[model samples]
Target: MTDALNAPGGLSRRRLLTAAGALGAVGLAAALSGCAADDPLAQQARAGDNKNYVAGDGSVTEYAKDTRKPPVDFTGVLYDGTKLGSKDLVGHVTVLNFWFAACAPCRVEAPELEALHTEFKPQGIVFYGVNLRDEQGTAEAFEQSFKLTYPSFNDKDGQVLLAMSGMVPPGAVPTTLVLDKQGRVASRVLGQLERGTLKTLITSAAAE
Candidate 1:
């Protein structure tokens, strides 16, 4: 993956991170090496949970204002063919969840995500799903099953993921990121979301 990312016309890790306003080179090195022994996602991988996906332990990281990187920028086409970009998110709190239809945790969290989207929409907050592995039909089916109102990006080619490579792990499904009004990542949920916890995270980011 690293090699491919650095290949011609591909995004190198450093360049991607820098472009997305993610942690700097030094910080990226630390983050890559700092996976804790007790991290649920790591433990699940080693244990062969057979869940097919490593579920996050609902861990959350909130970045302080001074420590936040620059605003993130990327362009993507939503399922409905609507184009969305970082500029669309400016001055608004945004939530981006990486998911595919079959991920169990994603299925479990869909309703909650939608509820949060509805609850916060009037407050000028936006939510978007970055569908990593599904085609438009499958993604739409999942959304219909959950009755989700917010639109999702069809990230099949990994363009959105590539843009977000620094902050999101390579194949970590069900990861959620909260971006502040300035478009910088303000917080993140590593696994399945706990509604109250995400709500608090969103509320805090909105407050800022």
Candidate 2:
């Protein structure tokens, strides 16, 4: 396991195992106490409606430079078969969006994400989609339909997701994370991204 998986205050193996088990009222209350009442993950778990995805409230969190955790560590192959790792993201501002083709919020924000990619790529900012579920053909079709220029990772087996489990909620589709030049998470957006908000976040990360 990488540091990202074992970072302080992050999800631990025991917690994950507990989360994977049945959540009765007492268990649900315990989980909710660990996070904010409105936290999408906890809220979704409480709903018990089998929605299969958490619809965040578009919350944005920016970590101060000093408060940021250690640089993230993980590795995965891109949809195009290019291997990438956290080390590769060092010295550049990077954005990672978690999504799947079936996610309605993901579809809604695709153009905005692509637009941001176009605007910032010239400035050396990077963007990648951490696709949670979808076969190659389905993912490819979604990309083609959106005319997305960036490549997504085929994370169906969830290596990328597992590595990022500390930072990202397990089933929060359409979450976006911005990493600073040092590969530490700088900012995060949970839910459908707002173009201006994300643009500002990218700009700030790039400036740092």
Candidate closest to the true structure, highest TM-score: 1
- Per residue, candidate 1 scores C-alpha lDDT tens digits across 1-208 of 1221243444443254334333222222232222223345434443546276756765566676777888887999998889989988998999999998867667656666887799899999999999999889999988886778999999989998888777888778889999999999888888766666677678878998
The models' CA-based lDDT, in order, is: 0.74, 0.74
lDDT by residue for model 2 (1-208), tens: 2232244654653254233323322333442332235445334433443265678766666676788889988898898999999899899999999998767667656766787789899999999999988999999988987778998999988988897776888888879999999999888888766676677678767887
Q: Give the TM-score of each candidate.
A: 0.75, 0.75
The 10-residue segment of model 2 with minimum total lDDT is 19-28
CA RMSD, predictions in order = 12.2, 12.1
lDDT of 1 at 65: 76
